[model samples]
Target chain A: MLPDPQAGGQTGSLEHIALLRPLSAEQRAAVARQCRWRRFASDEQIIDHWADTQDVAFIVEGRVRVLSHSAGGREISFTDIDAGELVGEMSALDGRPRSASVVALGEGALLAFLPARPFRDLVSGHPELGLAVMLRLCDKLRGATDRIMDLSTLGANNRVHAELLRLARRGRRQGAAAIIAPIPVHSDIAARVSTTRETVARVMSDLTRDGLLQRRADALVVCDLQELERLVAEVRGAP
Target chain B: MLPDPQAGGQTGSLEHIALLRPLSAEQRAAVARQCRWRRFASDEQIIDHWADTQDVAFIVEGRVRVLSHSAGGREISFTDIDAGELVGEMSALDGRPRSASVVALGEGALLAFLPARPFRDLVSGHPELGLAVMLRLCDKLRGATDRIMDLSTLGANNRVHAELLRLARRGRRQGAAAIIAPIPVHSDIAARVSTTRETVARVMSDLTRDGLLQRRADALVVCDLQELERLVAEVRGAP
Candidate 1:
């Protein structure tokens, strides 16, 4: 395995692989060599469902949406991945058809890696690397399970608020109110919350009117994080 | 690695790991030696959430429930695994915290395989085994993704019918009108479909009275599979 020389030695490191923590210097070097940086424009299909290709990606920068569509045109966005998060691990580990479609939400860079036959041989030959990959997949599964539980129990309003809070935390800047850029369209919010766009629109309008959030030039400014968290608590039926 | 003594060297052979297809003699022998059989009684917790253990299990007999709960006591049963299917592959592959809980529905037998280190080493050492496991995981993930989509888009009635059909296909015995034994309690169904137990009970009673199914002494029996499928289609809003 050779590291992409063009990456200028700034490609994503093993630390980005959060599930496989505490890597030694040698192990980090080995993994870093296998990673190649690739960039995608906004709205580009980073991973296509039903494609036969076997590339797995870890987001180095930007956001990617995990989406599914029904026969009747109903779309559901199960989750999103941002900087330092992993995607395509399921297809990479399982070698099956991609379960859903993934698209870049904006310009983004990813560390693309493929552990084909040679990689497998490497894993078998190097138990530590194989263990790291396995652990990483486990972390992905754990996160997915939590998302499933949340979707099952929480209502759409709560789901929206939780997602907003998550995005705010991810993109927060020091000493500045959290500003979520490229305010997601109502349809996108509908897909994520598993509700109709009309419903999402109504809720967003209500929130805007109530001074909880403000529509900005290119983003949605969450004026009060505490208020959002309180709404989440209320949705969870907390006192 | 040693083959099970009781199985007379047939253990882990192509015949044993039938869910994994097209295995070579060498590959079969390798898998056989690495396999271990175990048993659990009804309601036994086969896997606990967040436990530090690593073993992938294939159900040789009986049933198992896959479930998760929220901090506030909400429970959801994603699905149940019956004989011939594998469980714990996600945890086994990643070696992270267990995402959910698995409990035996009845007395069950399983062929448990060790920490992914050995099997993955085996796979990396042997491409055939690695490919076989990948394909199996792919199939499972596909099914899981489809179920998630159904839960997000379909109504409660459709969810129940689809689950019943799934159970019938997997649990049916020869010429017995498809007995779905040990019917899932109403609350379980409610959680699975994101509805209330009262709603689920009312729907079940309606279906029973409509002659599509029969509430048997020991199990729920689908009298006509076609009618049940039609009911599911109708509930899904099919024209």
Candidate 2:
């Protein structure tokens, strides 16, 4: 059975989390005790569109897609949330309904925490925590703004290349070759890049032929960072 | 002569403005004291791109265009700020150099306020004030995101029509006919919609010929909003 939600023990350490680094042991304990781990199968709905849920979750494992739908049920993707990123934060902060839906891309685990009132009270007691969360929100906003600009201004090929570069950077660390194993499906790439699946497939084929990337089992591995960066720069009109 | 930046006294009232209604008298006075009124000639630069100014300004009169430049110095416009709209709030929040340049479309007047530290301090002291600003920011983010989706997903003509409907809503109130005068130049619309000028012009002409809009001296007067909304629904695949 799952542990009691009201248990007062040190639930887990929060120090290892990048955003929670400044919290004290006691505060970390408070946060960990409040958090509940939940699992979802592939394609499970973690949050429904327009639902009012004050709980904020951190992805502990696997991936999820954030998306919106039209009245006629056409889907438009916003972003993909990877492990270690916070989800449903803006809704929790503003007490608003979810603006988009979140669905697990595969079997995933999330550390969900609820009742923003307690969280706000904790932040009030600890101003540093509030500031840290605000800074994280600002960083997310900056990224969303850049993605909007990219989608609006860049062409399909450049957008795909940039997305590959970003995924590589996120999947690998400094001095280690970035690996984006088991290439994302063409339709998934199209959704993220706001292009058609055929266009994405064409671009991928071209990139493979140019020797900038290699095809793995259901994945495309980026083999040449220099070439990818060069293509991006050329598209962006960089020197 | 311009008023002294440090001089504190009575100033113009912003209570009549729709967007400023949430602000209290004390808050208005606090903001007004830090404000300096500036006048600009036609085609003058109101805010330079990449400048380090941290002041947020309000347009008391006339109009301003927010535009960005690529690394190669190619300019793309985002939107226009008309009378009574807040300008430059994003820069104030981010503390970064201006993301885009603002230019006066005609002779105009703006109330520039200084020392964002004090304004932010005021917000921190008054959570309600901060909430109001946050709501406005959220609204702007939603609009920008929607525009990005439109540019990527909609055809050129559909984008032009959607833009017209957006402008009509902003320029008109409920139960009132929208008398949108001085429609933006076709070239400007092209930039904002992320399409070619010729395409924008062709679409606008077609819209006028279809009786959806009537061309005026300086604007395109929207005649039938219901029809335009229907077109938008059809294009966006709504029920």
Model 1 segments more than 4 A misplaced: A1-66, A79-144, A175-177, A205-212, A223-239, B1-41, B50-63, B82-86, B108-123, B171-188, B234-239
Tell me each candidate's RMSD, in Å, in order: 7.8, 4.9
Model 2 error, position B159 (Å): 1.2
Lowest-lDDT window of 10 residues in candidate 2 chain A?
A1-10
**Candidate of highest DockQ:** 2
Q: What are the per-residue Cα lDDT tens digits for candidate 2 across B1-239? A: 33423354435554444455577887676676677666676778888876779777777667888877555554667777787776776566668666568888866555555466765564455554555555555555556657756766687888888877877876754343465666777777777776678988888788778876777777667887777888898877633
Displacement of the residue A50 alpha carbon in candidate 2, Å: 4.4
lDDT of 2: 0.67
- Candidate 2 docking: what grade? acceptable
Error of 1 at B184 (Å): 5.0
TM-score per candidate, chains pooled: 0.66, 0.77
Lowest-lDDT window of 10 residues in candidate 1 chain B? B1-10
DockQ of each: 0.22, 0.29
